[model samples]
Target: MPLSLYLLAVAVFAMGTSEFMLAGLLPAIAPDLDVTVGAAGTLTSAFAIGLVVGAPLTAVLARALPGRWSLLGSLLLFTAAHAAGAVAPDLPVLLATRVVAALAYAGFLAVALTTAAALVPADRKGRALAVLLSGTTAATVAGVPAGAALGSALGWRAVFWAVAALCLPAALGILTGVPARRTPQDAAERPAVRAEFAQLRNPRLMAVMLLAALVNAATFAGFTYLAPVVTGTAGLEESWVPVVLVLFGAGSFTGVTAAGRLSDRHPGPVLATGGALLLLGWPALALLAHRPAALLALVFVQGALSFAVGSTLVTRVLYEAAAAPTLAGACATAALNLGAATGPLAAATTLDTPAGDLGPFWLSTLLALSALLLAAPLHPALRGTGRTDAPG
Candidate 1:
């Protein structure tokens, strides 16, 4: 892997910290923001909405710019958004900042994934993408827990400030390390809105995007409420939540690394296996929520499975949309964020019901099962040509 790949990972770590740290801080944020926990949770959805809207929009806007310049612009905007979030005066202000930050985050990720794949051989594309995604796993392990701890001790505002500080180095890394290069095709193929829109008509590509969305919905539905689930249902103290998150992150890191190596060879089987794991794991977690040891184990397992599916989802989209790799990457990001936005909104509705905390797990199980069913058709489409080059 090139140093640029790792630099992209650094940018992702900063963005991922901002994206996920809010989950752990929801409890603290609710009281300070004068809203219910469910309402505070909308912040996650708001960020997702930004991603849904921003990914393709940024793709269009930055298509004419150099990759390095595009990344730097997004990171600069992202860092400023975090700073604004740190000093937000009310819920609306804070939510606005989240939307802004997510826009930049989504754009950076789309560009980074495309750039990472471009830097490596076709055979190693999956691993290259995985290296970029490892930044998110690392953020979940280190950044999220630290944000949680900071929120517990200082306040949630401090966490935003910390995220802003982290982005400086990430921006500098991109500025110094990432090269400015475009493939011959990249230069010749100018941005065309109608052409990009037409790509959506491809059934296989659409199915891959839907699969990505479903997988994220399943994962985020349960995960958005993990702090409360662990403390209220799993019988753990608030302090232990970060520890469990670390464990989950560790599993995610392992899963992504493993999936990266396998997805290039067996994308279909890997996708099927991940979906099956989620279908099994979420239900088990729901049934065993009262048991702390079992709950802990299940969380780790679910995290691993969720991320394995994620890695494969990206790989499949890239493989199927090889001709429009950047736009396809943007579409994948948008699809996942759409699911991310919907998952917590659905979970919030469920929280208001009699089922309460356990509702999310069941919701996640259903989503995973839906994803599994979708995978059935995808295997045939991917059959012998899973490794074929996209038309340039």
Candidate 2:
């Protein structure tokens, strides 16, 4: 892989940090902006709305500029949006900033996917995408926690300022390291815009995306409300929540990087085994969640399976939709955002039930099982790791 691919990871690290760290800062933001914590939570919704609304549009509009230039422009917009957010006078202004930043984030990620994959050889495409996504997993392990610490020490606004400042270097890296000329994926290699959208009608790609979304939904279902699970169900101290998160993050990072190396060589088994373990592991989690040790172990295991399998499914989507390079990235982005949004919403329904805190595990298990069943029939298509797209 090229040094420029790692530069893309740097940009992804900044954006991923901004995307998730806001959760930790919400309480401070709510009080500071004179809104309830629940009201401030709408900022996340605003971010989701931007991703859902902007993803396809970004894919459509990205062809207007060369790949590196598109990345540079989006990073600049993201930086500017966060800087505005840091000084917002009210929640509405902050909310608007979140939407704009998320839109830019979507654009950056869509371009990064194709750009990263294009920089590498056909055989290394899956790993290239994985390298870019490592920035997000790294954010899970370190960046968000650091942002939370920054929020605690300097205030939440300072966290935003820090994120904006970080993006400047990433943007500079893009400007300096990434190529201005378009790659095969973006320039001469692309199909017509109408042809790109036409891939949506392909059932193989659709099914793969469905599986990807379910896997992500299962991940979030178990993950989003984990503080409660760790403290409430596992009976661990609140202080242990961060430690559990680190375990999960470490496991996920290991899983994804491993997936990068293995996915192109063994896509089918990678997806199937991960999905099956998720199906089994979630039940074990629900049953033994009362045991602190069992809960901690399962948290790491589940996180590993979720990301390793989920990453494979994402690569499969690109393979199935290989003919539509631009739309492939956009579709992967949409599927992930869909799962992330729905997972917590689905698990939220079970919080007051007899399952209580353990419901997320049960729900995640079902979602994972559903995803695997969907993938079972599609295995043959996914198994083809080599390039399947025709010449330009």
Which candidate gets the maximum TM-score versus the true structure? Answer: 1
Question: Candidate 1: TM-score?
Answer: 0.96
User: How many collisions per candidate?
Assistant: 0, 0
RMSD of each: 2.0, 3.1
The candidate maximizing lDDT is 1
Q: Write the per-residue lDDT of candidate 1 for residues 1-392, one digit (tens) a residue.
A: 88878988998999988888877898888889899888988999999999999998998788878899999999999989989998888899999999999999888888887888888987777898899999999998899988999989999999999999999999899988887767788777754667767866788888878888888988888888888888898878889888878878888888899998887777767777777878999999989988999988998898899898888787877777667755867887888898899888888888878768888889998998898888787775533253456211
**Model 1 off-target regions past 4 Å?**
181-185, 189-193, 382-387, 390-392
Stretches of candidate 2 above 4 Å error? Answer: 22-45, 87-94, 183-189, 235-237, 385-392
Model 2 lowest lDDT segment of ten:
383-392
- Candidate 1, overall lDDT? 0.85
Cα lDDT over the full model 2: 0.80
